[model samples]
Target: MNWQPAKKQNDYVQTRNKNFSPPTVNQVLQNAQKMIGPISESPRLDAQVLLAKIMKNSRTWLVAHPKSRLGAQEDVQYRRLVARRAHGEPLPYILGTWEFFGRRFQINPSVLIPRAETEHLVEEALGLLRNNRSVLKVLEVGTGSGCIAVSLLLEMRSLGVVATDISLQALRTAAQNIVNHAIGDRIDLVQTDLFSGIRGQFDLVCANLPYIPRKVLNNLQVGRWEPRLALDGGEDGFIYLRRFIAEVAKVLAPGGSVVLEIGEGQDEEVRSMIRLGFPRAPVRISKDLAGYNRVVVFET
Candidate 1:
């Protein structure tokens, strides 16, 4: 349980291999199976990933060489990662990078961590872009970690994107992802809240703004580690959604669409507000894998 700076990477890896405690692969698998559905649903897979990361090897390589002894440094690193995971730290934060939409994205504490639900937004957006193959102007509000924006750019490399965030720190992190992904020239990162500093009309506007009510945020599991600005959505949690609906009409191109990631139980209200604000804007609700209404699309 004691944390220490890694003396040497390989030394840590070796220690993890020798001190894993589980007697056999089956034992390790059993322990992982038991851990799943409690803290993390993918405990078995997470174990392999954490072990592979510590071993500085691919997941396939780790699977192929599970019994291969780790060097001293690799063992220590594996134990450190496991200990962190045993607490509540996310695996992506520990690995420092996560795969999103078939591409690698660097993640840090500066921005809200990306989630699977948000990927639904990406899927819907891509569907929209595919339907309209023309070069499109896209804007992503609250582009934390640039996960959504970067993924869009990577998915639709030919389009131009403008990604905005209220936090300079988040923008910095997002900018890094842009550059790292080699899409620096294709997308722009602006430091602004919503579309305050943005100009012109975009064919599509995407926002995954904070939608957690101030009251509920404190009790949410995500509130423990994520930035409050990314979760606290005022008293009712629809403050930002309402405001976005009000202002988006002015900035949206004729026949353009707006994609929003909504919070649980707020989809109906959000869709209603979007309709009331932009009566001409066609509003539709989309659900996630869990069958929750998680995305709202507004066509102007």
Candidate 2:
């Protein structure tokens, strides 16, 4: 399943015939569209992104310089990236970075690529902490790319977060983001199974834990490239959710809040689990812009 540029002389000959002259940005977009249109939802946009990456320029620049020609090396790299995307590797993975919560973070197959839906989780947490200016400590379970934790640290000056993940590789990705954002001193990255090695209480505990059922994951395009530890939520997609509810009480400060990103249609079930786990805590679910239940927040 290696995805590299076609290397055979015959392949090169065919490419040479197809591209007699160096490809202009517009021609490359058309080529990418033809190659990936069947699998990609927005083939033109995907082409623009890939070309932008190759040219080390912005998408806006691509749009303005459609007549500009790609160098030989640039054309080869663009084709290789397009081939990778056409084969189901995520665009963010191919680009090696993704924007989340208005900031860019380094990403790879080792961690789940941060999604726009997860931004709701960050917003909900920020809303809860807005008026509380006092020094706040937060615990983030399953800090994939550290997007949630780092975004929080950036938005809330009084906040400090301890982020944990079972995958050492994921922690490394998060670590790079921490340094990139200059939040290295504010975040502590630990490798442990959901709160196993964590200590102490915090003003808030948040997680975008794996909530996709094993069966459901098999059908997802994302399942092909993302780490299973970051996507598999066991048989019912609540295995980790239930476990977090069971153990979070120990490290959650009194009056501390917990926010989580849940899969679609699991809102009521997750809220019920929260009630059962912490009968005294108040629970509520928040929907994303499209109105799907996306985040669950509770206070102990």
Candidate 3:
């Protein structure tokens, strides 16, 4: 797999620089931008955010107080984190928190970092279920950090969610997020591969399962940094998704829906599979901010 390549870590790590003194916010950001430019798409923003995180201040604060110097310990910590980022570690994993659907979620390498594209899946679910008068029951196939399930519960007051993940470590990570959002009572975190131990009908099913095809995953930095179990979707990237489609009819209530975040060009393939599972269910497609074919939906 192609891990994000960076200039050597030793170049960035001074490894904590015991003799190094604190530097002004602007100075440190300038240095970090050069250090992180290789692996990050947004070097300056990444530098600012990481430094702001270390400083316990906002990026705007950093801008306004560009001359403000970091403490000795904070400087060391900032460089240490910069080294980790320079080595291809994702920013969210380094920071331990990521914003999804306007809320911050705790994240680790154990779980897939929540992506903005998946918010379309969440919105698709809410758009279909929000007006329903009854309490909507939701089944999230791979809960990851529980961001999707948690986002749903927060937006709609009448949702009861049952979220499952194959990895116990991933589930533990999701559990922390569930607690962080104070939605534990409303959601059940289960450790199961797909729908293995799951039962009962649901009003809606939403998932951002691993759909990165093995070949594509092989060349992607995400596959290197994110959990393999949460990124690999077998040879064609449809292993888990196909399995979910096959079993969905058995668990979905009449008129219920399935919302999924699919790969950029997998819309037709996913639609074809959904056709086999729910021949008559109407399918809807929604694009992400980048206009990629992203969230796909089908209703039973």
**Residue range with the least summed lDDT across 10 consecutive positions in model 3:** 1-10
Selected candidate, larger lDDT, 1 vs 2:
2
Error of 1 at 72 (Å): 1.5
Candidate 2 Cα deviation (angstroms), residue 56: 1.9
User: So what's the TM-score on candidate 2?
Assistant: 0.94
Name the candidate that leads on lDDT.
Answer: 2
User: Can you write out model 1's per-residue Cα lDDT over 141-164, one digit (the tens) per residue?
Assistant: 999899999898888867899999
User: Which of the two, 1 or 3, has more lDDT?
Assistant: 3
Model 1 scores a C-alpha lDDT of 0.79
Q: Assess each prediction's global lDDT (C-alpha) against the native.
A: 0.79, 0.88, 0.87
In candidate 1, which residue ranges exceed 4 Å CA deviation? 1-38
TM-score each candidate: 0.85, 0.94, 0.92
Candidate ranking under lDDT, highest first, comes to 2, 3, 1
RMSD of 2: 3.0
Clashes of each: 21, 0, 0
